[model samples]
Target: MTAFIFNNLNDMQANINRNKLFVASCLSLLVTSLSFGIRAGILGTLGTQFNLSASELASIAATAFWGFPLAVVIGGMVVDAIGMKKLLVIAFLFHLAGIVLTIFAGGFWTLFLSTLLIGIANGTVEAACNPLVATLYPDNKTTKLNHFHLWFPGGIFIGTLIVFLFEKMGIGWQIQVAIMLIPTVIYGYLFSKLDFPVTERVASGVSTAEMYKSVGTPLFVFMFICMFGTAITELFTGQWVGVLLNNVTDNAILILTITTGVMVVGRGLAEPIVHRFSPQGVLLISAILAAIGIYMMSTVTGSMLYFAALIFGIGVCYFWPTMLGFVAENIPKSGALGLNLMGGAGMFAVSIYTLFMGGFYDRLIAEKLPEGASMEAYRTAAAGTTEAAKYAEAQLTAGPDVLKATAIIPVILTVAFAGLVFYMRNKKKPQLAGA
Candidate 1:
């Protein structure tokens, strides 16, 4: 009776600790998503203040994406050796320094460096938390991971709303940047108080050699490549929402808010959907919806933009978490390194694509301009004159053209996911036959 009681008490205590750790993890992720959301909101202001070209703004934005993969991949490789607690501490410090630097930034280089710091912090959060969540709920990794990742869009919703409201209140971009410090402090405190568990791979006793070897598998390689599409289709579009949809709708930032709102709800309810469709099926369906939604966004205007954003949001809602979960479920031996590699690959691709998209948007605008006319020359022309009107119209057309080009990414994803779904179903059939 005494042993039983003691065991139950220990179990209850563990549950409490798990809940606290989970909350800390969510808060950490919230900081990451907040950075992304607020950065997206502030890009235009940064461009105007710095007098930056489209490509320059994109390069600044891309710095975060670049920094992300570097930290995450390294964090994943060393997470077991140094521990999750230490990694999160690193994240907290980076986030703090980054936010402070960004608030005091004087130009493009400062902005670039600060954004890179925040990106490193963001990557480290995923490094620790993803494996942390997987270890915490071993039996339900997919559902719980989806639940954990809800903060990505949820935090974005919160961040975008802050931007939308504060902009109306005439707040400066620095204040908006500084607001992230609140969550950063809270999460840092929470993590400092808690003890962490080993990653799922470590706990399961999977050999380090085995983990590295599994990452080189054909299936893992295939998924790694596909990650480029899914990530670009989802993150790139969201990050560029303000610029891309500026002409399509007056409420450009609001569209991001609405989309993220949809994602929050969808991710919150991921368990049932994932169970019904299987991860592969969900990926397949999500890709199709994303394709349709982006295509619609390219052509739609006004109120229809909201509807298209809804579909796009729902489509992408399942992507990041599901991809991570699928690997956790199907490629267990790949371990933390595998998980982080997947994320690293995704962000790296987005970083490259951001630069390309920015340059592409500028090129499209240039193409639409009258012969020998530069954007600078047109901007300096008198308001309401033909040159200025032509520039305005060119800017408007460029945004939609960017969207139209982006639609191709999801279309590619749709095909890739379809193949993945077929492969997974066939792979399962042989198991069922053996059973």
Candidate 2:
């Protein structure tokens, strides 16, 4: 009778600890999304204040992407060795320092380095939390991962609102940057008190050699390539909303807010959708919608932009988490390293594509100007009264063109995911037939 009571107490305590760990993971991811939201809000401000070109602004933004892949790949490799708790501790320290450095940043390099630190922190969050969630809910990996990742878009929704309201109140960007510290501190505190579990691979007794071998499978390779497209389709567009849609909308950042808002809702209700269609089917459908939405966004204007953004939000809402979930389900042997590598690959692709988009935007702007007009001359004229309208018109043209080109990425993904869906269905058919 005493042993039974003790066992029940132990079970209760374990459940309580699991809940705390999950909550802490969510808060840590919240910091990452908040940073994304706030950075999107401040991109234009940074450009203007620092007298930066589009490419330079992109370089600054792309630094985070570079740092993200670096940290996630390394953290993924070592997570089993050093554990999730230590990775998160590193995240907390980097986040704290990054926020402070960004707040006091005077120029481009400071901004670049600070954002890199924050990016490392963001990657570390995924490195720890994704595997942690997969381990915690082994039977329900896809559904639970979607639930865990909902906080990403949810946090962005909250962060955008914070930026919007604070901007209305005439607050500076530094304050907006600093506000991220609240959730950071909370997650840090929570993690400090909680005990972490071993990664799913460890708990399941998958050998390290087997884990490495599994990631090289043909399907895993295909998925790794697909991650590049899906990530750029979602993240590149989300991050560039300020610049891409600035001329078309009065408050372009609201487009990000609205998009993320839809994402939060979609991810919140993902269980039913994922179960009904299966992850592969959902990926195919999401790819189709994302293609159409990006194309529509390029062509649409005014209030119609909101509707296009809604379609896009729904399209990308399931993308990141579902991709990770698919691997966790299909490539269980690949384990935490596979999950981290998938994420890292996506960010690495985005970093390269971000630079391309920035350069593309600038090139388009240059082409739209008078035959011999220099960007420097145009900037000088626009600052005064004479060419401001012309500059605006050029942005109006260039921005949509950029979106039009980006639309091609999702179109390719649609074809790829359709193939994936078909392959997965057929792959299951033989077993069913034999059974």
User: Candidate 1 deviates by what RMSD?
Assistant: 3.9
Off by over 4 Å in 2: 1-16, 380-384, 428-435
Error of 1 at 224 (Å): 0.8
lDDT of each: 0.89, 0.89
Off by over 4 Å in 1: 1-16, 379-386, 428-435
Q: Give a tens-digit lDDT track for model 1, residues 71-128.
A: 9999999999999999999999999999999999999999999999999999999988
TM-score of structure candidate 2: 0.94
Summing lDDT over every window of 10 consecutive residues in candidate 2, give the lowest-scoring window.
Answer: 426-435
lDDT of 2 at 83: 93
